[model samples]
Target chain A: MTNGKSDLKRLSRGDTENSGGAIWHENFRQAINILRSHKMRSGLLIVGVAIGVTTVLAIVTVMSGLDKRVQQDILSVNKPYLIVSRFDPFAGTKDKRDLMRRKKLTSSDAEAIEDRCPTVDRVDLQVNAEGMMSVLRYGNERTNLIQVMGASHNFGYMFSFSIEKGRFFTKFEQDHKARVIVLGYGPAKDLFPHRGPIGKMIKIGTHRYKVVGTMGSRENIMGSISDNYAIIPYTIYEKDRSSKRDDYQIAITIRDGFTLEKGIEETTALLRKRRGVKPGEENNFYITTSETFKEMLGNITKYIGLVLVVISSIGLMVGGIGVMNIMLISVTERTREVGIRMAVGAKKKDILQQFLIEAVVLTGIGGIMGIILGMFAARGVAMLIHFPYSVPIIWIIIAFVFSSSIGLIFGLYPANKAAGMDPIVALRAE
Target chain B: MLITVKGLKKIYDVGSQRIEAVAGVDLEIGKNEYVSIMGPSGSGKSTLMNILGCLDTPTEGKYYLNGSEVSNLDDDRLAYIRNREIGFVFQTFNLLPRANSLQNVELPLVYAGVSAGKRKRIAMEVLDLVGLVDRAMHRPSELSGGQRQRVAIARALVNNPSIILADEPTGNLDSKTGEELMAVFNKIHESGNTIIMVTHEENVARHSMRILRLRDGKIESDKIIN
Candidate 1:
């Protein structure tokens, strides 16, 4: 019996007082109240569901954050851009020797694309080779071995960057093949520290190039790559290389009204013409866009995501079974109560609704706990792997709906069993 | 007549055995009549009480209550009839263990879709009638045997049904507590509420105005008692 205040006045006059709420509302209140009272039982009951929802949500959130990072940060420097490499930068089946033997491109090819293709916008040439890594130094402070890349002045502006300090070299400095440089994030941090590195000179190989600016950091998907390189003027690169044509790669931008497809087709046709390829032969080059990289990443992770979802679903199924088992035990345990209720005039549907609501409330609470834990899990992993932390709100809603539906789907049998009881037999149960 | 039964029979199938718990019996009572059914163990008194309470349907027979054919109704309609016309009290005090006395009393109104305010007020009325309004908040586990039965009585009275069917209502109570319970029943009866109780105790039966005795699933005797 509840300890409601014994209002002396209302005791004698049954007054047909205004009782409130629908039958289900009462059921819901009672269910929630009881669950709240017995925390440990409900918590244990919902653990399976919580684990399932956590697995799916954490994995999906981390994966989505990585995917977004790949699209906006790593793959596409500026959205709707293309990269023309001599061979596939990401494909795995390529013969390395054959790729090396393919007709190498030069800075002239990048110039030709900029000059001839109507859809081709500004182009930046990258002329780095496999052994271009070198340790940089200034005032006795040094950096780890980092890639040395050479590109046009606008290269820093277009690729994974914003100028953190000062500015990139101008066209005049690039034309003069001046020894000015824009240090990468790692080099700038190591060589400059508190004292700004802008305008200070740093040694790269044998040359001392004045630091014009520093590039902002970019976090690649795999922690392997980083903004740890030094960018020099392309002309200065040519002046230092033994051969000015070191199989260059061109980064191309599409005109405002044109698509990357248009830019790729135009550049391919123009390059094939310049290289004297016959109409039928494949152009001795590969083109990549944001979409291509996304597809490439998708192909690999698609399997992983599928496996995680299947495992999570299995967890949910197990959780649902646990719920059904508990519900069955509850029905058996409350058989006498069920009989008493029937004697007091509760219908079969009323019993069914009571048990069904109980199941839903259980799973629904588990789902909420899972969502909170999953978000925390996602944050932990995102920070662990250096990915931006984000949770897809839609997936949260889906997880909740999915968990409660597990209740609806699996709770049916036990609820039916409870509702189908013969009041006499039930009342007779000990 | 407020109640009537003709040739009512109930046969239960237990695997390979056919047990006729109630075999071909008939009886009747009018509104506001307080009746006691007396019988030894296995006398079909319990079975007949189940039929009258609408907790179970007879295997064969016609039953009329308040001028309507009760035996022919469907499960849902029977539930409605039970809600509106019949209340039941059991030997074990069958109060929902988790619910308080107030909640137990309000349960019938909840099923009847009465709002919370009216339910509380009406349940309080019944609790006061049983002189346990101050114990409204006590759960079954917290109450003594007498107090628990009093809560059960309040629950039976909450809906103000036409008749209260009690099967050995004090079977689990001490004689002193049982006598106290009979006093409550006498008070309800004096207020013109009809009650039919099944008990093997002759002293308990003495509280009722009329007594019907049963044996071997048949009425052995019917008599009016002081």
Candidate 2:
């Protein structure tokens, strides 16, 4: 009974020790000292972690930038519109030959959709001569080769943009196949650096066409909006610019009170009926929205990102295992010191924290190095490709936290082993 | 009484063999007493000293330090007692190799959660008491064996612990240096502190006011030296 009472009393509180958080400052110094003493081993672990983090950061930055570029291009029309085409525009070039096998959908199909699908508010047709890289020339001044598009009369309204300087062409001009042309800001600025381009006759290919207006500025990067393009009437293009390999695209806006999804459904049904596609068979053409383009870009990026992540994880895994092994060895090497510390009043928790901090400091330094290197790589590529320059601050923060967490995870077993040691046996260790 | 032990026992399992390191030893020590424990190599003197210092618990017995039974205390509380009540001086001096003499002395106070300024001040006081104030910044490897042991002694006294447990404090020092350390110990005892030391040498045992001899895990004799 007396022994039982003593055992019960033994479970009483250890009096809070009155020791504040200030006691562990020496532990931090000790951890730094320990890591410093083994420079080669610590350096190897840091490099390993740095490589993994670098891979993750570089891949994430490139993929995000790619998405940003695709989004900017897909939404440049500035309206919630549908693009009906022969194949998916944003499917990438991986399987071009297969996608090209689909049948073409012409201006006739665009006309039918506008008439049959009441959800369609307005429709515009554009055609690109696949290889028409025409140079625009003025008096002793010439601009680089850029594709010229043949658009309907209401192209400016459909694009939700007005001319920056002059007026858009009229329906009579499109119907009469007039020789008037409008230049995108890029080409307009180049051909008329010192003078106004409007009403000026510029040579496109073998013919002279008068510049009627200049499109407004959008992005400085050479995205869809800022492309150095020249636009002429659809009738003019069909007569003078249409080649055997021309590709036609139909842009449609949904009528008021119609959901985009409902409009798309109606258009798809009508197109299938018009194209004579059999029931239970795939459609002979593609219809995409801006959201659809975004989804396609996301799918491609997700696959590439996953692959890169797995590879970097393998690198980090190897690095983490290396850290754990060296930490175990460190615990063994410092067994006597741990015992002396215990005899001087250190709790098991104190020893565990000491080793854990050492591991984190080592990997934390690696994380910083990796972030710097990855930013350099991303910035270099962005400059080369003319993407918007930005610091991926979120990914940098995530990488740092992730690398520190790796140390915490891998350092646990070794630290627990150190803390669980019997002080007597540790003191007796040589 | 500063310490009391009733039928203390310690058993170790080495593979299938059961070894009784300490069996049925009863002892008492009063405040400010200077005592020495002596025995042959396998006579369990180390095990008994470890039990007395609360470094290891007794398997079957009662241990009271400062009038409270402490043998059944859990590890955290036992660590607290080790920090606040008992100071251990190892045979090898056990000074942390990389730490300077002052930092070594401040170890116990650091664990006690003493603030930085107070820890340094109190550590300096103990270093002065051990006559190592001039060598406070010198690490163990840079100091002589006797100087290193004095640093260890200063560390042991820094927390103002109730008892100092010395395990062959002079074992690594020359005879002259050992005699000097013994004189320091005598001075410490006269200034009202309890000290327990373990050694096999009779001359070293003579330095203490009382001597206890151990044989086969039991107390063979207890002698008082006036």
Candidate 3:
């Protein structure tokens, strides 16, 4: 029996006048209740989502931080755009050897370019010797495999080194070929602890060089050049017993408004003039731009990041499939509930939204927990490696959004099937 | 007329063959009426109740509820009518096992978009009416068959629908408990809410003012006893 008067009133006040928010909240609350009813199933579903988000977040954060460190290390060495060297490879092989024998870069070559080439702003000449070595000892413990570099006085300005304990070598020391050396922060602390390293005498192989200053901890770029080396004067390295005329590498900075191409052209012309290289002869030495160096490092990191993402994606995919399977089970288990809601004026859209939101909330909460755990894991890793712990905020946001969207996308078919159930059949189901 | 059906039919296609559940039926019921359609197994009384409750639309002919053509209505419209006009109780006392009596009573109002505060208040009032107010927080499994049936009745009354459709509402209870359920139904009818019940027991059908007996998919007799 139906009463028209009350039926119309109920229709107007009940379903028609309710806002979408009210419907959504009611459906969401019911879904939460259903989840509470099946605690084990809900927990399993959440763990799936947590695994997915954690893998993604961890991989992304580690890769992004490593990428930043690599870039910073490259920038500190040289301006990425300029390449200044003596070698010209475009002129052919026979001429390259001839040019190499005659036109090897030296300290004078760097000076001539700085004077003649308007594009050359600063010049740094580095001389490295295989015979150059350092001995680090702390109370009978010593390391013999320490590399030592001979650098100009402007080494700190050119390479962005922060003096942690003492001062850098002065211009007078470079000109006079002083035997004083500066120790990087790591080597200094390792060799001498609980005492200041400045004004200390450290033996480098057979020679005794005075420690003048100490460098700060430099960012490690994929373990390439860490703050564990020793810096000495370029002139002093040249005059040492193991030094030779051929063991030199020169780096130069370009002036403002000068392109790398111009710097390369001017430096090549100047070297050719100084070394008497014929027009048809090729240059001997290799010169690389900072941009090219960075490109090489970036390619390595890109390949590494790609591999990590692919590996992490495999984990996430398995987790996503698990989530989908669980949602399917949830739909089948709640068939009668779906039918009852459908019979009681819930639109198919309403049912769909309710289940989908439930899935998303489940995964979203899991994702948030995973992110928190992953951040701690990353921090633990960074601490183990003695690197700074950085939170990857961008990856965190992406993980959250991606996990919820995965829930929505994967939960759709099951939710629709549940919403389409026939009430009579469902209610009559034993 | 609160409900009118003319030549109502229901056909089910199970695999290759067609089975007629309700062949042809003509019936009218007025507001506040307490009526029971009684039949043996496979006699089609349940099919008639399904049509009357808007859980199933008639396969052919017209069925009107409160002067609205409901037989040809789509699924969404049928759902609206079911939620707004018909409240249902089943033989098994089909309350959601996970839900307490209060939440079970609030289910229909939730779909109707009633505010939570008002929904709870109305659900409590209906539970009080069914004498299950003290057992409101107890789930269906915690209650006896008689108490569970009372909880289902309270759920059916919470929406204040135009009619209550009970399909053997006391079918699972003892005779004493069944009598008590019928007494509750009698009190509900006296309160001016229409009720349509389907029962196989003649004694249960006798509680209603009117009875329609069905056999072989058609009404065998219709009688008004009160």
Q: Model 1: DockQ against the native?
A: 0.44
Q: Candidate 2's residue-wise lDDT over B1-226, tens digit each?
A: 8999999999988999988999899999999899999999889999999988888999999999999999999888888899888989989988888889998998887788776776787778678778889999998999999899889988887777789999998898888999999988887777777899998878888999999999999999999995
lDDT of 3 by residue, B124-170 (tens): 87787788889999999999999999998887777678889999998
> Residue-wise lDDT of candidate 1 within A1-430, one digit each (tens)?
1321133223322543323355787789867876886687778988878988898889888877777776666564764568888888656765877777777777788888988999977888888867657888998899889888788866865765878899988989988999998887788888888798988988977888899999777656645357788889888987875353365778888889998888888988998888888999987788887677777777666677767777778888889999998888878888998888888888899889888998999999889988999999999999987888899889899999999998887888998998999988998899
- Docking level for model 2: acceptable
CA deviation > 4 Å runs, candidate 2: A1-17, A73-80, A84-123, A127-150, A153-173, A178-232, A236-249, A252-288
DockQ top scorer? 1
lDDT of each: 0.83, 0.83, 0.78
Greater-TM-score candidate between 2 and 3: 3
DockQ preference between candidates 1 and 3, better one: 1
DockQ of 2: 0.27
lDDT digits (tens) for residues A224-294 of candidate 2: 53557888987798888777778888889898898889888998899888778899988767888867766
